[model samples]
Target: MNENKEYFVNEEDFIVSKTDVKGRITYCNQPFLKIVGATQEQLLHKPHNIIRHPDMPR
Candidate 1:
């Protein structure tokens, strides 16, 4: 795994997404896909926690 790699959202870009009432992603824009490093098929209907990094601070 590329643990040292990081993705950043450009200042001029916007992240957009829609999740179900249970917090499962239903739709996401390109910026969201880029930041999360996932394709639409990989993220659709998936839990938001799928993007949580183990090293991320609580």
Candidate 2:
């Protein structure tokens, strides 16, 4: 894990992302992109864990 900074989503905002039953990302909304700092192309078909922070508890 590298040095990562946290990005916050608004309390009233909804961050939408969809994953397959196997836990691979299938779709993600713009708000999800902003928070993850990733482009749609980067996220498509990726594992949902791609955006997980190293500091996060397992």
Error of 2 at 49 (Å): 0.4
User: Per-residue CA lDDT of candidate 2, range 1-58, in tens?
Assistant: 8998999867438889999998889998888899889999999998898899999975
Which window of ten consecutive residues has the lowest lDDT sum in model 2? Answer: 7-16
Steric clash count of candidate 1: 0
Q: Clashing pairs in model 1?
A: none
TM-score of each: 0.67, 0.72
Candidate 1 TM-score, C-alpha based: 0.67
Error of model 1, residue 58, in angstroms: 7.3
Model 1: CA > 4 A from native: 1-12, 56-58
In the range 1-58, model 1's lDDT, one tens digit per residue, is 6578778867438888889999999988897889888899999999977887999873
lDDT score at residue 16, model 2, on the 0-100 scale: 91
Best by lDDT: 2
lDDT of 1: 0.86
